[model samples]
Target: MPYSNESHFHPATFILLGIPDLENIYSWLSVPFFIMYVMAVLGNGAMLLIIQTEQRLHTPMYYFLAMLAFTDLVLSSCIMPKLLSIFWFSSTVIYFEACLFQMFMIHTFTSVESGVLLAMAFDRYVAICNPLRYALVLTNPIILWMGIANVIRGVIIVIPCPGMASRLPYCVTNVIHHSYCDHMAVVKLACVDTTVNSVYGLTVVLLVIVFDVIFISVSYAMILRTVYNLPSKAARSKAINTCTAHICIILLFYTLGLFSFLTHRVGHSVAPYVHILLANYYLLVPPVMNPIVYGIKTKEIREKAFKVFYKKV
Candidate 1:
């Protein structure tokens, strides 16, 4: 953390180049971008309201789901408005400190979301694999502690990136190639070698994201194994059905994360526009989709949502 910025070129602001090749149609692109934002906000908002109202949903699984929904809200909100502003108004210049803050919030909530997903997977494992101890194990206090731990872990991992980024000599171009400010993209603007920055960022992705994915995968695998040995078809079907929403979300989240990461790091020949599109998709899609998936897959939530809407109507 000890560094000298005496020779570093500090800029007051950074220019965000919204999308590479699709600059001409930025106004048109904002339409779909706006729709995704609406979907994410309304969907996650509705999910939170539903979770809060339903006393039956005060259980562990629903608690984890609520946390996931909240995380989606924060995760998407961190970037969408700025992206929309860049697209619709060509307001692409962000203050340097604000850009770093955006980078922090986006990465922090993303890591927290991964942790939330891991917690959900654990919830599922306990419910299916050890039904007797589910209540005792994942008590309300324990769940609250898990949520705090997720946020703390994310903070610990990402707090350094922005600090390191701040010390870099950004004598290079201020133009960022993507829609929003991310650690790697911001680092790309730095004129310095940034080897330590790159190493730390890569280490975070590999150690934190990959570790969560592996742990969630193992949890699902064990849950599936337990389901396979169920005494009857009906029980097996029920168990699989219970996990269907979470499994779909896990696949979608990791699939998008992997592709985005690869496009940024490994896809040298890939189109620049594709990189921005994938990056936006990675942030936007899950929040928009998660509520719909949960509503469809969770009978209690589905029924409650319908009742709530029907009453409102």
Candidate 2:
């Protein structure tokens, strides 16, 4: 809140670097980003539409997928428009409050997605290991509470992020060498020591991403045992098939997340551009890929999506 005595004025703006070292070719890069953005939107939108209108999709798995689609839609929409604007129009200026708000939204949605994946893992575990009680285990009331708990956890944990960063006196540079206002990237620009922010960031990741990954892994371990013990190959194959889409999603989401986390922490070994690029990929890839993966791997949703479209024509 207070400016450094040296500057005598609190900084009020931050500049987001669209993509470091690529300003000369931002126009060239915009094409693919634009295409991915459009595809993510349309694909996720279609997934939501079909899941909403199709009666057969009114199940726990599809319900979680719908939540995933909605999260992706929000996640992509929050970042890409500003990123594209920066790339094309060179509109890199972001107000201090706006930057913090963007950071909050990004982190919040990320946590929500992680929680959703964990929910899906549990959904599979119940359906596979306790088929008779699947309905009772993951009823609408339980699912709704899981969703609410995920969101509340995100909000309560992430509140300190922007607050910590904003309270620091940014005396020198306000230029963030990243496309959007990420927690780490923004806090690094502060002239004061950022150990608190850094530690808090790491803690958040450990609690949300790492903890979820471990839980999902354990759930799938149990799932594999259950499926393997099935008396018939048909039953085993059927169970595994049902989990395929969720498995792909979990792999994509966490792999990119861990990579980005590592790159941010120890990426000094590589080019800064490499870190920057991976950071962008870490955020963008899941949103673009999740819908495509689900659309292809999950048969019912895919067929229903086709039906939904065909009816319009």
Candidate 3:
């Protein structure tokens, strides 16, 4: 539906009534969301500390993991507080500038997350397929460059959002269905044509999803071939076990991500709530579960994390 004629909208600014009728659901859902946010913060924080303090985890895999945890911390922080406030205080209104900022941060962190995942896949591929050159291939310089590249990619991909939002005239309804300002959600409110914004957003999604998935698949294929060649059953099993958690994370993130995107574009009314839930899950679940997955599957991280916790106590 086009924007309702409730309020006059401004091109320079817009009032966003966040998540219409959110007050009714806020009281009940806020408690569980608060608990999950706390756990996510603690879990990802502990993982980062363990990786930083432990000498054994100074290698490239753990280095990338540390980066991943940091990204999760950032990604969660960007969205959760505003969501919490909206629930706890029933403050659903957001200013236009603030909305744009939120959208930019969300996209930036999302792009960074994709880049980090791809980097981790490459790390695994090198370790399994070409162990002889693993250390040389994933040197400190290479890892640093990967971090830089991730930041650059995030900035480049999301640069269009604010400009697009700025140009569009919002002369109609301003309520956003979700808690935070999302790219498409904001664009949909625009009174003017949003073809440019939609096209640009779709392009970024394709690059992140299509290009990144292809690279990750290729990396895993090489890793799988190497695993199959291993003579010892124990070695083969161990290698597969090591990759299982990452594979699970990748599947969960991408599947839900694509599903949410598709639903937003194609099947809006019937599955709006489902899309909303999946959108939140796509952002929150990986960060929450990643630590658990790595803690259980990776012996070194598990041991070190416990050791650090005990020492602090």
* TM-score (all chains, Cα) for each model: 0.97, 0.96, 0.93
Comparison by TM-score, 2 against 3, better one: 2
Best-performing candidate as measured by TM-score: 1
In candidate 3, how many Å is residue 208 off? 1.0
Clashes of each: 0, 0, 0
Which digits, one per residue and each the tens of the lDDT, describe model 1 over residues 1-313? 1222456676778889888889888889999989999999999999999889999988989888999999999988999899898887889988888998999999999999899999999999999999999989999999999999999999999999998898888775888887888898889877768889999999999988889988988998899999999999999999999889998998899899999999889999999899889998998999999999999989999999899889989
Error of 3 at 147 (Å): 1.0
lDDT tens readout by residue for model 3, 69-100: 99988888877898888777766767677888
lDDT of 3 at 150: 92
Q: Point out the worst 10-residue segment of candidate 1 by lDDT.
A: 1-10
Model 1: residues with Cα > 4 Å off, grouped in runs: 1-7
What lDDT would each prediction earn against the true structure?
0.90, 0.87, 0.82
Model 1 global lDDT (CA atoms, 0 to 1): 0.90
Stretches of model 3 off by over 4 angstroms after superposition = 1-22
**Of the candidates numbered 1 and 2, which has the greater TM-score value?**
1
